[model samples]
Target: MNSSYDSLVDLFLKSLRAEKNASQNTVSAYANDLNQFFIFLQEHYRKKADGIELEVLSHYDIRSFLAYLHRAGYNKSSVARKLAALRKFYRFLNKEKLIANNPLFFINSPKKDKKLPRYLEEKQIEQLLALPDCSTPLGLRDRAMLETFYASGIRVSELVGLDLPQINLDLGYMVVYGKGAKERVVPLGSFAIEALQNYLRRGRPVLLATQNNDALFLNYKGVRISVRGVRLTVEKYVRRLADSLKISPHSLRHTFATHLMERGADLRVVQELLGHVSMATTQVYTHVTTSKMKEVYDKTHPRA
Candidate 1:
């Protein structure tokens, strides 16, 4: 609302990109969350007996904002994310000496409901992989892309950011830059390697035409594919394969990790493959695998 608010957010976002190496999506989410919070503050203080300045903002004001979000029908996860944005913003202000005290010090994010990540069975994955036609150039690219997701369990952003130099088809692995721009080597499966090889030999060159782009995956225009493009490709086949299935490109990633864990892969190894900074994030797949086991036991166990 105010120029000062805008400037502070801009500075904070710059630090996130420059210092923390945050992704564009992360920066945009934080910006949107902060803007929403500021808008609520403007309306809130407008009705108050005394307008509260940013420097003098307290935990009570933060709680009031959370209450407003709840009343406005924001889900717990969404409210928690907004709260995180506020906390980070206030911390930045305090560090910059723009504010004397951080009002969000006592604030806590809302507890989220523990929903297990969705993953596909091997049969479903096989069915999904078969849906992409490899006869055409775009089909070849989509097949390679889908194979890569399941093979490496990489995030969509990382996959789309791939360059010609990052992949070593001969070695059966590729280097990917994950969150915070961290670099790691991910191994590719035989099926993925073959698909990628076919795309490179037949599909990619046709799409490349006269263009000189070094991007691993290119659109018909010969430019690197966008994250949205990859998602749409994944969605098209997923919808064709099964209308009831709620799968995204990320679901392929989930399938990758879940399948690995189901087969007794170590938690740390799965974490390393997924490029997770924390093991806790990778541990969720363990639950998914366990749930799957329980379901199988219920169906096949004679004692039950």
Candidate 2:
């Protein structure tokens, strides 16, 4: 009677934090979503969040919550994410023997809107890459980092997390640690290799400043470059040359994937390169390619 629901929720969240290695941000977001769901339950059952019983909650009850979110004008993607959080928490409850039946086991998740990622056109990418003045150490590092981004289509985290042993410039590939610390070998094109070589020889050493940082990319202080540092570096060049294009470092990542797919790269190959756990995630770039092809066809055809 003393808020058993709250106790179970705490146990589940603790599992996410300790066992699953979820970040505080992730745990907090999941916690907030569950809090919203419980508030809706409270409105229905007239009980505190911890007083709601497992036997009383049903799939229809969860569906009603989804409907409530929709009525409140929550976007489809947000609704879907909330449902995902529910699924995880309920699964945790079931695993802990707190629930006799998983109420949400068969519940269908809310459909999410299809969103195509934004990317730079090839010409625009070339312009952005050229904006970095390679004469200076910081500029050379930025240039190499950007070159590696486009060449591999790597997540900015993976790009910045790179270390000396992870890269094999001579072999034209590098091992990228991705989500959940999963490892994948991504090919680095010659342009990326050359840029990396230059930075290693000229830029990184100049910035090293007698510090023993093993991080492949370094800041002005000769320390590991933070994610913000990479984003700002890209933004500076992008704001200068491609002023009209409101893009982030991920735009270069998207451009890398879209360009490769447009040039007839295998979808699975692109998936591996991008470190996508699902081919469906990689398939979004195909949509971009198809759209581009249609645009080209519409513009160039003379038979109309």
In angstroms, the error of model 2 at 19 is: 9.8
Per-candidate TM-scores read 0.73, 0.76
Q: Model 2: per-residue lDDT, tens digit, 1-304?
A: 2367667778889999999999999999998998888788778666554534665677888788888998999998899899999889888877777776677877887667788898888898888888888999998998899999999989889888999999998899999999999999999899999999999999999999665678999999998899999999888998898578778989888889899988999999888888888988888888899988999898999962
Q: What lDDT does candidate 1 reach at residue 247?
A: 94
Candidate 1 minimal-lDDT segment of 10 residues: 44-53
Model 1 accuracy (lDDT, Cα):
0.88
Error in Å for residue 84 of model 2:
4.7
The 0-to-1 C-alpha lDDT of every candidate, in the order given, reads 0.88, 0.86
Please report the candidate that would top TM-score against the real structure: 2
- Model 1, 1-304: lDDT tens digits are 5777787789999999998999999999999998888888778776321223777778898899999999999999999889888888878878888778777888888999788877788999998888877999999999999999999999999999999999999999999999999999999999999999999999998899555688999987878999999988888998898889999988888999999988999999999999999988888898898888999899999996
Q: Give the TM-score of candidate 2.
A: 0.76
**Candidate 1 lDDT score at position 120:** 84
